[model samples]
Target: MKWKKLLAATLALGISAVVMAGCGSDKAASNGEKALVIGDTTFNSSNEEPDVNPHNAYAGWACIRYGIGETLIKYSDKMELQPWLATKWENVDEFTWKFTLRDDVTFSSGRKMDAAAVKQCLEHLIANNKRAAQDLKIAAIEANGQELIIKTTEPRPALLNYLGDPYGCIIDVDAGFEQGIVAGTGPYIATDIKTDDHLVLKKNEHYWGGTPKLDKITIRTITDGNTLSSALQSGEVQAAYGMAYESYPLFKNDKYNISQISTSRCFFGKMNFDPDSVCADPAVRQAIAMGIDKENFVAKLLDGNGFPANGVFPAGPAFGGDKVKAEKFDLDGAKKVLEAAGWVDTDGDGIREKNGKKLVIKWLTYPSRQELPLLAESAQATLKEIGMQVEINNTADNNQVVKDTKAWDVYAMANVQAPTGDPEYWFTVFATSNATKNQGKYRSARLDALENQLSREFDPAKRAQLALDMQQVVLDDHAFVFCSFLKMSMISKANVKNYTSHACDYYQVTADLDVE
Candidate 1:
């Protein structure tokens, strides 16, 4: 996890390599005009294609981020919930809620976004989208004139927050699912999709928010961070997202504008708690936690771009409470813990062993974000110094690799912990026993209880206390090595106006975005 500094050294050369590789070209015009091109590193056509289904978490968010979709509620630039589609909502009971839809809203396909449409979309998502199905726990969605009544399986005080998630976007079900085309209520309509390459979107003339300034938008997929930066520099792209921290220097000139927003995203290593897993032992997990220097990792590796994490959540009121602080880095303490746990370097091969079994750990990661593999490599080097054998696997298919490989002990990944501005979402997705994203299989009764309390508590003060309690429990158990809070950066041409970054890391491009 400490590779940010080392990676910075090669940024110049990386950008040069991309420029030399012929990544730059003349700005492609659309309909006899310059189309605003956005280059992003996180665009994956395999999961995003076929209408950018809101059922898939990442793709759903991408659709919302790129202004191809809209949710019932949305977070403003100040991280406050604001009305988008549904003007207002009221809680009828502990499990029942009602939302009032905007009568003027219409899908790009000319379908009115009525209560019936919202109900159909919610029902489809609850039945098909695994994350939505689990998070919402909706028992029924009924259309009542211009309002929609939702009944959940349990008390959901943060139901509006959950509904504001990207997956809750209302789409023209007939057009999106049946025809495999994105017909949304946003300001843009997806016109063409070329898998793994680019997606073309046209301004929605029927948009309730009025016509967008740009007539056309081309979202180009450039997975490499350096190439994304080079594209912006070469005038091929008007804006670039997921830019490497090192590449910011390239846009320091007044001609370019850089927006860095600190988000709830945390880069961390998840330790598997399965009985046979090497990281199953608390001592081993603690040793691994202590082995990595998170302070230095954030300060030096990330070039002071990120905040060092102490607990599971990042620094914020909605998620990070007053109870969290950075864990002390103690390399000597780590060695002592391993030794006390009966692991020692018996063969003098620099790797600890117990009962003739070498203490080797398989670290799994992906390269979609250029920093992950580098972080894994850095963790490998640090763990090796602590007399642990670390094998790194930087694969494209992390899900398949994790499913097939039984040797994986640690998985380095990054996630927006509070995507919904609630701690319940993060805890339910990554900490609960039955969580789909909890690939590590970490389970704790106390943590689960705290999560349940957080979900049901309506009082802001009580909810914040419950969230902090959960963070303390996870920190005490050493569930994972919390690294740093990500600072999402967007580099764009100076003329790109109304392009602001949000803390949730969800909304990027909006109808307001325009070139001056």
Candidate 2:
């Protein structure tokens, strides 16, 4: 929480400076009006390439989505898998798949994209991309003419979905690793990068998708919400991504085109399950879950920008089934549950104590999403009414905070659980004993079995059933206190056309985008 005071002061100064600079600038209009400017707060990389490295998980999404890289497969607006760099693919056998590469595709460095290129990219991905390496479990990949034969260790029904992940972005193998800006086959190429400040991309006339409508694009990083809003309002930036929910009303006019797309991401709290942790008790976790007012948090705190989450996956039957619902907010019920579990307010103090220990919880959350810290504060007030003392640590570095298991009991975080449009992805990342992203170290045998079944089961109905069963298992254990599903919003000038939002939060600016 030490960084919060500094962050607030820094943000105030940054906002003031940006607002003054924006009010006096006419850069967007003066630059031939052909350049598209985007303002965003989610750029995590300071590298010159920004997110060109497929191995860097935090920067990979930005690289793939912003046309700096291309994946073999991509998801459609409807969340269906579609061909991108690879023209088409088919299952050769239970464990082997073959893909047909696009002959016309060429990297920015003029390297031809053939079956060999595809194989090299996949090989690099397997070595660097942790998620792809874990999910694919590929035994071998062979390039034969224009066909790529991929043999997995097991029958992976979601192979296409896994390849569609941003981490699976294909790059020019020769220049990708050694250069700052890797050569890609996408419509736009990174011409220049200024780390956290800005990125300049120029059109790739040789792009197989056809030349983009815009000649150039600039992505500027403005972390402060007020600065982003001001930049957009003053026409300093033509578009903005990840704007604060409270700033939506500022763009509710004809001049701006606001696109609100519901994503697979969910904001939730993870309870530490370490044996020595205070939240190790199942009743304590359940009590906290029962005390949270998810509906109110979404409606009031989020300004109805999101839906109350009931499980790891979102609402669709393809990923999240309809079996589970949001947990009811019951303060009295939570207090009774704690009392039955031997946590009682024996002394005059409001907080309950078990044995000689006070019922105090250390809560940790980040401020990047702009909603998590507020959610932490709200939960703190709500839990206190149930004789639980919650101490919140609002830090910018949650990854480091989670490492100290003894210092924190609950951690609020957000993730697109089913980014690949498959439930198995969520299970592998959160439910399994060896899950890399499972900071809480939650493990369940039943959930593991269900996840295994879900992975191989290709039948739609059967997969849905397995997904529902897995949700129930996690809900029963109270592994996560489900909060809300994110509805990401992007605001742009009215002239900016074809700027669509994807369910997975994958694609952003594409070849079809243009400014009137």
Candidate 3:
């Protein structure tokens, strides 16, 4: 189950390659016009189109829809919010807010955009609790002709952050959200879509702002690392999607340039914390954490593509970066803890036991990530030395992992976390109230208090102190074993002059990239 080896073995170039070039045409009509083709790792969401309403989990859909849609606010790389569809916003009171909508915006379907349309769109996403609904605290929204007013249950200073989410981008309501082809106000319009294949988008010439440089852009889906690498080499696709850290070294050819981007995404292992689960014991969780040397795991197992994670948040925020002194590996210490916890086999059966119970647990993972299963294998070998019975179970689909919350003993996979850097999100994930709640029903009070303190205290000095204190609690509790912070890499042709990437591996096709 070594993913690095398996991926490298299954590597092969994909489908008949197709290339198109016309750099010399229409130079005078548009200032910096160029068409670029890109490849993504998985098929984009079909139903989660962002242009209609909102779907937070939409992958390429979020970004692409952002280009074709509009938002009241947009986020800069600095994490600052800037005006987009809204001209100005006013905080009428601690819980009341108002936004003056821009009068010039229009949807792709030739419908004029207004406050009512925007309000409706936000309401749709808020109604569907599974998507962008939970992230916000909106109590009510009403459109006063050209002005939009919002009321929240609490004074949310981070309200701007929610609006800046790519999912919060606005869409047209004239086109039924559930039945629309594509209705948005962004710079581009999706002209055609081939499920699990490619999305063809053409620049909206009648856009409020001047038309984009590129007349057309096509995003093709290529899940195989080798296929994407070949696509970039053959010029079938000018850019490859997110490349694995291990796969980056192989693409060191002079023909293509590599770019590193920053994102809030990090890969970590969440141990089952329910009392009914075998991983509930702090000793067992600590043993599992200490068993695998994360530093070596990153270097040898991950081919040096990531850094060992000391906390849930990747190094930088107030709450992350510094590793807890106690969480450091002490293999002898782990053996002692397990022994003291009665996890020793008295029956000489090769497995540890306590009160006639065998120490056995299942480690669950998915196939999308070519790393977790391999890590599981290595973990099994490491834990076996402690006389623990460990089994790696490759779970099918994310739903199966969710279902296991009610039936299985353990689960391990990539969990996409919000980037706000607030510990409350973690508390919500692990608190009892959140169990069977979005975070898999894992509950811990220590984790909750740490998160609560991090949320309201926005000052840098205070926030940093809280983050450090909370990180210590997280390490002690072992609700999750912080693993590694991934480094996002991408391969594009040398001539792909303006192609770029974000740390989270998302791309902004219009502003950040272009081609000569």
Candidate 4:
């Protein structure tokens, strides 16, 4: 079969490939011709809704709607807070915040969005335990006729960052249930949302912040990286979302035209910290960390879009800690640790033995992300060097791993950060929430205190210091051996320009994209 038809089938079936070509035909929009085309992997939030009304309910889902839904504040690329629906906001006291709303803004439904509207939106989130609702217990959300006042149980410096997320994006109280189309105060409006397919948007004519330059935008969720790269090359879509690193070489020569950002999606193989499991020993965990050659794994397994990680913070301004020194490749060291842990080869076979038990282990991973399976295979090979038998298991369904944690000795997966940069938000994966979290069920009281302190610390400098300290605590404890910080490679046709990505993973659609 021809590649185009093959690609069409794979795209329909969600399979990634390599080698792509096609010249896109320039088509004009129809009478209501204001739409933008965007490409992504998934659109439906965990809530499984095409669109929702209340902001903060769905992080990724909210972002798409929030752009149409205005927020109390906005954050620039430089991470500076700016006013949005709320003209200005200030701290009335350590526990109280006052926001003066902009009376001129109106929802697409022509309903006036005022202090009362903002109060209603915030109250809903506080009432429901939204994940991003970490800082500021939100003691109360009140509207003083014209101004909105919010009181917190304590002072929260990261409040602006949380509100800047899509969940904080405000929408029309009445148009909240409108699905398939996006409606809010953003510069653009979502007109159509197709499940596991595509999304279409147009500039908001009712936008109070002056009209956008482009008239329309469209976004499609194409799972195949090669197909997306081909779409970019073929001009089927102006830009493509996630690309596997192995495909990066195809566009390496083309410079100043195709734009790519070195993003941070850390990947690692997590262990089942079930106290009953052999991997529960920190010494065993460290040995496993030492056995895998991260530098080579990332260089060979990941191509070029990865960085070796020492801890959870992604090695940047947001992450700080006493450098625990990089994990070195030491086959002998791995052997030594295993020996110290009483893993010995008593039989003539090369595999280790401990009280008649073979050092056989199972590693679990999913195909949700393309890189995870390959990473797990490399781990299996690396562990074998120390007389340990390793098995590789790959499943498309993640619930299997969740339901059968005891069956898995090690599980490989990617942990994406929540909208709030706070480490506390991630405890659901580590805390004693039973096995309700992902990765290994590891817990530490020190980690708990550090996470709690960082959340409440309103001072930027102090908060950063605490975050660094928290990373060290995890490092010293060997919590899920840190691997590489994965980068998001965005391939786009030359015509697409000025596209931007947020700190949190979703792509924003607007008039910025144009077909030259």
Q: Which stretches of candidate 1 lie over 4 Å from their true place?
A: 1-30, 45-51, 178-180
Scored by lDDT, model 3 comes in at: 0.62
The whole-model lDDT of each prediction reads 0.77, 0.78, 0.62, 0.61
Q: Best by lDDT, which number?
A: 2
What digit string (tens of lDDT, one per residue) describes model 2 on residues 67-167?
Answer: 87888888876788888888889898879999998888888767788888878888887887676799988999999878899999988888888888877
TM per candidate? 0.91, 0.91, 0.82, 0.82
* Candidate that beats the other on lDDT, 2 or 3, i.e. the better one: 2
Regions of model 4 farther than 4 Å from truth? 1-36, 42-62, 65-70, 134-136, 178-182, 213-215, 252-257, 262-264, 321-326, 345-361, 416-439, 502-507
Model 1, poorest ten-residue lDDT window? 1-10
What tens-digit string does per-residue lDDT give for candidate 4 at 1-516? 221332233342221111111224322344334333445543433223344344433533534532556567765543457787788888877777888888888765566778787777667656653454554468788887559888877776667666765666676554554443334677765555555555555566767877776665556656566676666555666665565666667766543144544444567666677876667877677778788878887888888667777766566665542244545678899899889989899986888887777877777766546677788878888889888788777765554554576777777767654444554444434442232354467777887777667757777788777766766666676666767777655665555565656555443554355555
Candidate 3 per-residue lDDT, tens place, 174-263, comes to: 464431234678777665454556655656777887767666666676656566666666666777665555667766888777876555
Model 4 lDDT, residue 154, Cα? 76
Overall local distance difference test of candidate 2? 0.78
Q: Candidate 2: worst 10 consecutive residues by lDDT?
A: 1-10
Per-residue C-alpha lDDT of model 1 across residues 431-498, encoded as one tens digit per residue: 88878778888889998887877778899889988888888887778887788888887888988877
